[model samples]
Target: MGDHEVLASTGVSELSAPGRCSQGFGVPDLNAWFRVSVWSDQGGMEAIARIRESLTLSGEG
Candidate 1:
């Protein structure tokens, strides 16, 4: 399957909020990965930067 198709098949199986942190699950790129993270405005900005860096480094932005 294509990348978009692979991504589209993923779904959040569960969600949990613990204090200031939140986490969820899904198959990431057909790898069955569980994604988790803490919630914060500053963290969002940092994640943006990291994503940009990844795209630029991979020449996929």
Candidate 2:
């Protein structure tokens, strides 16, 4: 079996409310995710593209 390395990062940002705020409607915002892979050699640097998407409390994709 081979061992797998995993790395994770997170961040939060504040956004302005939409045109109008309803009784229960919340403000609009965004979340981002980035994945990267590092090597032990000096050959070169390699990185994966950044992934950004909307987020919810339920953790649904």
Candidate 3:
């Protein structure tokens, strides 16, 4: 948390709103997380690198 944590999730763009949770697709099961080779290995680190590269290419993050 930061000094302004309470106001964190609010919309930065004027067109959006904070409280609008969508009727999204199917919820994932906890079991799916257990099956991934993430945090316990370099797979997690690689994921971050990939995301950074993607954001750099797309000009947003």
Listed in order, each prediction's TM-score against the native is: 0.28, 0.20, 0.24
Choose the strongest candidate by TM-score: 1
Best by lDDT: 1
Per-residue lDDT of candidate 3, residues 1-61 (tens digit): 2121111121122225332221111113211111112242334535533433443111121
Model 3: residues with Cα > 4 Å off, grouped in runs: 1-38, 56-61
Model 2's alpha-carbon lDDT is: 0.26
lDDT of 2 by residue, 1-61 (tens): 3322232343212134222211111222224333333332321121211211222223223
Evaluation by lDDT, superior candidate among 1 and 3 = 1
Q: Which sections of candidate 2 miss by over 4 Å?
A: 1-29, 43-61
What order do you get sorting by TM-score, best first?
1, 3, 2
Off by over 4 Å in 1: 4-18, 28-31, 39-61
User: Please, what are the lDDT tens digits per residue for candidate 1 over residues 20-56?
Assistant: 3333343444445344444454354345335334431
Q: Between which residue pairs do clashes occur in model 2?
A: none
Tell me how candidate 3 scores on lDDT.
Answer: 0.26
Give candidate 2's error at residue 48 in angstroms: 11
Candidate 1, residue 61: CA error in Å?
21
Q: Model 3 TM-score?
A: 0.24
